[model samples]
Target: MYYIAHRLFAAHDRALGALIARQLAKKAGPESVFLPFCDTDEEDLVAPVKGHRLFELDRERLQTLTGMIAVLHGPSLDDGVCMEIGYAAALNVPVVVVTTDFQTYSADEHSPHWAFPDPLIETIAHRVTRVDRLGAPQLADSPDRFTAFAARNQAQIETAAAMSVEAILELAANNCPAPAPARAEAGTVFLEPSPHIRCPEALLDTLHAAHRSVTIAIRHQAPDPFTAAHADWTTALRAEVLVADVSGPETPPGGAVLIGAAAALRRRIAAHLPTAVITHAHGREPNWRNLMIQYAVGTRVCDAHSLARWLAS
Candidate 1:
């Protein structure tokens, strides 16, 4: 099966998604192409899905996918699509990233990093397809023009989908990366906590007892500049173990990305490096945590004590 990750929060996005899905299904089979907007449970249509449940549902579908074709649209890559790409890559599942946007938005052309579509994401992907001049057809003047514009530009949309589908089929046929050699245990434990953690020192003090070689990267200490942020993420992926604290009512966006990347790395390498996701004891409800992080890490919430125990064991 193939999963198409794209933005569907807008009317144009939904219409384009349907068009792409239809074309992909024609070539890959109706049952093979899974578009989140079209294939979701019926109840999701009637009401808003609880955050955790949505994450759980997507991750479950991801596990069964043979390859993923992620639409990297807009000036910046969508955070959720990045998570899906990272997660799928970690599982050694082949990924093909398709972007119709031709405008350049790089920090520096000479630099090894891309300011858009994200360098790490591109690095992990098996194939990157750029359909020049066939940019998104949904950039109509108004919302009402979306349908008419799509209808008029059907040829361009089909061309883009056809190119993406070609890449997906080719990659799926022969591009699965082999898992790294398994290790008994990972060397270092990397901790990513939200800036909102209460009594941070006490929490670290407790965890330090179980593991001495722990690296902590919180939002404040790590500069938000792209280069520094990229460096921190690269360092985190090198560690054999990852522990992310996602306590509180919502998962901090930055912390959630790190959790997703680390979890994918752990899975890609098999049982070599394990990832642990912990939340504050106060917010132990399953819905409090992002389902992608929870299911990908595959662990129960670890308070300081339990986290330390997990680190030691």
Candidate 2:
């Protein structure tokens, strides 16, 4: 079976995503294709399930999936879809990213290459099927318009889905080995230090107190130091375990990308590289807007004391 990961918040996402999944199922078999939002009841808005529960459900499904067809739509890549790609890639499952975004955004401002979303995502994909959506009309709130939008993009959707199916099959047929594990000291943890992190010294001190070796992988922002940030992100991905302070006044650019990488690393269940996210508990909830981060890591601690306790256990 294959998992279909896409943004589900909007009418356009739902309409286009359903069309793609239906078309994909015709080629891959009806039983071979799964869309979490459509197939599962756990995400129902009425009496909604916890984010982690949904994460667990999806992770379980993904573990058994032969490949993943991820819809990489919009100007910015969807955080949740990116996490799924990382997780699937870590498991050595072939992933095909299908995008219809026509806007131009560069991975590096200084470089000549122009692209939407991040290379941290696209670089790892087995294949990226990019369809042109310039002719499709904007989605309206009405159901008829939504249908019209899907109809107009039917050829593009079918083409992308067909390419994705072929890519998945081609990649799955190859027997490529997973990269060798990084040479990390036992009990070593990679710390993704962010400017949004509070009491960074205390986090370091906590690691030192536990007698665990640490590697600080910093993701630089702005003026887009793409190469440097990518190197550090790879460092974080290869570490034994990852610990990041996701406490947010606001999510820094590229912050979610680091978390997504860590999420992927954590899915290496055989390697046991657990990832921890540290965020302040606001009233009862963590003070973060992004549920993708919570879904990615699942372990969120409020302070160094809590972190130390977690590490100790």
Candidate 3:
């Protein structure tokens, strides 16, 4: 039997979680069940009252579950959700993270408001899926507009839920093999573009003229940037240069815990890939945290013009 684990905390989360569960349950075969964390009725509200019983029940469910799906949004990771993910990982349950917020780092006035997930959460999940919001008329404008908005939101949620179910099933089948090492040719450069950089086309042309094979890896807010970096670092068959854009400092949602968590993730990545970050002096000055990152990673601080010249050289 395949048991799927899920967490739903807030009122809206519970409503959405119930919708996902219902959809999964509808598609479930005789051998599969989508078990949500709220399925239990042991309500203590206060800690250490019925906490032991609650823990025991949750632990059993997690231990017996086939896989876990976590919904991560908002400013910080929920303590209970984190515990569930940790428990699932400890028991060798494959985990998938579904995130709703994604923000691009850029000074462009026309850019969309994308909220990146906590980097710590990004690092843990086996797979990360992004659920983008729908583009509909304002809910407060008219009846038709409100109806359209509601319908679009529902459709997007259902689509995300379906994708999660498919991922769980795929993991159970175990048909996917580990990704093979990327074969790097001589003079190959992996360019990671961010919204903060100006005119990457010219830079690309310069590298091309120098007989360098350039591969652009666009950064998605869902997956851990460090995870991708580590994979490329360890598994690339040939030597290649990673050119990462050091755009600006992150503005995490207001809270010390979140700020500290984001900082820790940045430091960890910098330590892992010290040479990947490329500083553009024309952009915002590397904030104190970013400076620490550059220093720790041992990345050379250079302007765009200098970087282009160096790449050509």
Candidate 4:
């Protein structure tokens, strides 16, 4: 049994959710049973008169699921979806989290922070698939925003749906084993600091002395330093290694400054430079920024001192 977990609180969400579920079901083969939360009529599970019963039914459904695909979007994880993911994890059901939004939120005076999908879900997901939000304009006054949005982004949406079905099939075939975690590589590291925070001078001196060519891409948010020395050091230089510092902005939205910068840098220097991201150690849950950076750069490191030591060695 394949389970589709997503938000259907709004009509727009439900429309898109139904389309995704349909595509998955069509591709998942006839023998595969699809249990989308939105299909209350087909699944014989309606929104309960009492909220507790809804969870009870959901738990029952999760136990019977062999594989699951979840849609993750917006700024945070929906509370109900988070609970469902936990349930699936406890049941050892393989889960694929499909992130449908990649565009950064427009920053304004009222909201300086970036919107990111919840790190917890990003961590727990057995596999993560991203669909770049093709340049679909937000239509505030459209009578059916979801339909309009789907029309505009049909190609990308279908691509994501295909990938979701493939992941579901793979999970079912594998009997729901957790995917192996990515291993971090050791090399000359590219250290990217969060917006506004400068790389420590001691770190820079050590990097220079260690024979590693380092390029520091300053955040657009920070005031450009005036000195020639600063200019020389901050200029983007090509190297065999790229290390991003993902320490700042506690909650950066999708397309966080470092993530965007690293992605651009990767594209520009990918033929020569392999990239790595350095982040502060948090709990085991993967940071959304870290995940994005990992997607851009092939390597990631959590311990700054350890990475520096490795560079020195």
Candidate 5:
């Protein structure tokens, strides 16, 4: 079962945290284990985190925790909780936010969720609630002040067919830790249209951003530079990498390997970002043109674009 952690930075928010925990327990393990780490005890807090263990946020054991939740409902968020959310996010464990007042301005979900919402629309910009205040604030007198988690942050999570289109589909909704919600918004860069659009320079930059691990599928085995650089980084940083090398294109034939890889990783942790590529290593250019392939990094290549567009996108 997946471990979904509930969050209550304040004693006042125990009820919401407990409620979120119960809902998440239903979607358990087929995806991941959600574990909510906290400081207070079950009795002192609003409610108990059933089916999971609770730990103090600043404790050493918290460092060993695989994940955390930044419950959006509370008089105010806790500083420790924010640190845990960001830490877990960097570790690639997945950080899903739970907030009623999600900063989704612009009359559309155009910018990063972390970015401040449009100033004109709602001044409650994406403050990221960094200074986790333990007490309630003078919430805006507007009806926006959430009484309970009337709407989960999931409701605000959006998906679009095209970048310009201002439409969104909610994958899931709740005031709990949602897996890579912000990261998923960054579209998969690999699924571009053209083959010659690759920028190895950019690829290295992306790879370098990987903190915990990177999953790479080298279509036509790209070149040694990408792999070598990644390998060196992984070794030095002690990061893990999962590479599904299409080395034997001669054996499996072109395009076949890519299709299979795409299907396999389709349900992976994420389906966005340019996670795969078809490099010149496939064969000689004049003799054998490189077959176009798409792979997702943080996003799934739902739409087909040229290699250049994929990178540029």
Candidate 6:
């Protein structure tokens, strides 16, 4: 029974309010609404746990209890919610959002904030009717349908819950210090020669010299990409290759084919390479000085940031 706080006070506030109660009641039943009350303020939230009631908690004070419960409504891009969501998300807490008319994406392109499920984005409304969003239509619309929806997307829920709260929070804290323009950690950086500036030119030479057996990893395996992109780099090396492409068949914004190609190539390379990469990510990652910290060299990259690497060559 994890308590939650809804942020929206107007418009879809009712929808979000109903959403919280309905999901909790349906998921863990009565006990789903967990509350350790020490004051009168606590009693007020109980009614909402039973029916379409609103629970009022001082958001500023209860942020400490992030491990116990989760957030229902947030500022989307505000500092506090950003920090809390980053924490709750990494901790894999039960995050139940309550923005009736939810905002899917941010307005500005350079710095944008996306909703949860950067995972569930695959299932949002297509038309975007609003700014930030996914276009996939949902099966359940009412608050009561929340639990069932959670059940269907249990895999997604698990991902959210399994995050290390402390690790993520630490990453957030570290973000305060600006990262350098280019810093390749010892013994794990590679870059293939590019027709254009592509990624880092030195990276390819470093990997080739370090490992007798090398692998090419990219996010895409398109015709001219993984194979073609590395044609020149791999030609001379006798290293075994493993192409790791994770790009989907979906279309990208701005119809930038090269951007998609770059994303694909970088992901594949990151998978098997000890190389830390920050290629431009397709979806919802904040940029730190024109680059996002994407280190996928280890199975998966952390979302601390995103990057746009050169791949023209």
- Candidate 3 lDDT over 193-254, as tens digits, reads 44333535655676577676766543333244555434433322232554544433321211
Cα lDDT computed for each candidate against the true fold: 0.60, 0.62, 0.47, 0.50, 0.29, 0.29
lDDT (Cα, 0-100) at 156 in candidate 5: 28
**lDDT per residue (tens digit) for residues 179-229 in model 5:** 331222132322211222342444334433432233343322333333432
Write down the worst ten-residue block by lDDT for model 5. Answer: 160-169
In candidate 4, which residue ranges exceed 4 Å CA deviation?
29-31, 34-38, 42-49, 103-116, 135-150, 176-313
lDDT of 1 by residue, 1-313 (tens): 8898876556777676677778788888989888885687423444344445566667778877788887777554554666677667656688887777666443445544342433445555678777656335554465577665655466566677788888888888886465752232356666666545543564568657754566776423433335555555666667676665655444443454555666655532111112334333222243323345455564544455555555555
lDDT of 3 at 122: 50
lDDT of 3 at 161: 79
Q: In candidate 3, what residue range of length 10 has the lowest lDDT sum?
A: 251-260
Whole-model alpha-carbon lDDT for candidate 3: 0.47
- TM-scores for every candidate against the unseen true structure: 0.63, 0.70, 0.48, 0.46, 0.28, 0.25
- The lDDT ranking, best first, is 2, 1, 4, 3, 5, 6
Strongest candidate by lDDT: 2
Alpha-carbon runs more than 4 Å astray in model 6: 8-15, 34-83, 94-113, 116-313
Q: List the residue pairs that clash in candidate 1.
A: none
Superposition-based RMSD of candidate 5 using all C-alpha atoms, in angstroms: 19.9
**lDDT tens digits, residue span 1-313, model 4:** 6777776456666666677677777777534555444533423533323233444445456667787787767665443444456456534578887767874342344532332332324434678778776636655565687866766687677778788878877877877355432222333444544333554566566667767666554333333222321332224222334454444433222113223333333422111111333433222233333332334444344454545565544
Better of 2 and 3 by lDDT: 2
For model 3, the stretches where C-alpha displacement exceeds 4 angstroms are 1-7, 43-48, 104-116, 135-142, 175-313
TM-score leader: 2
Instruction: List residue ranges in candidate 1 displaced over 4 A.
Output: 42-49, 108-117, 134-156, 180-187, 191-210, 214-258, 264-313
Residue-level lDDT for 120 in candidate 4: 28
Against the hidden true structure, what lDDT does model 1 obtain? 0.60
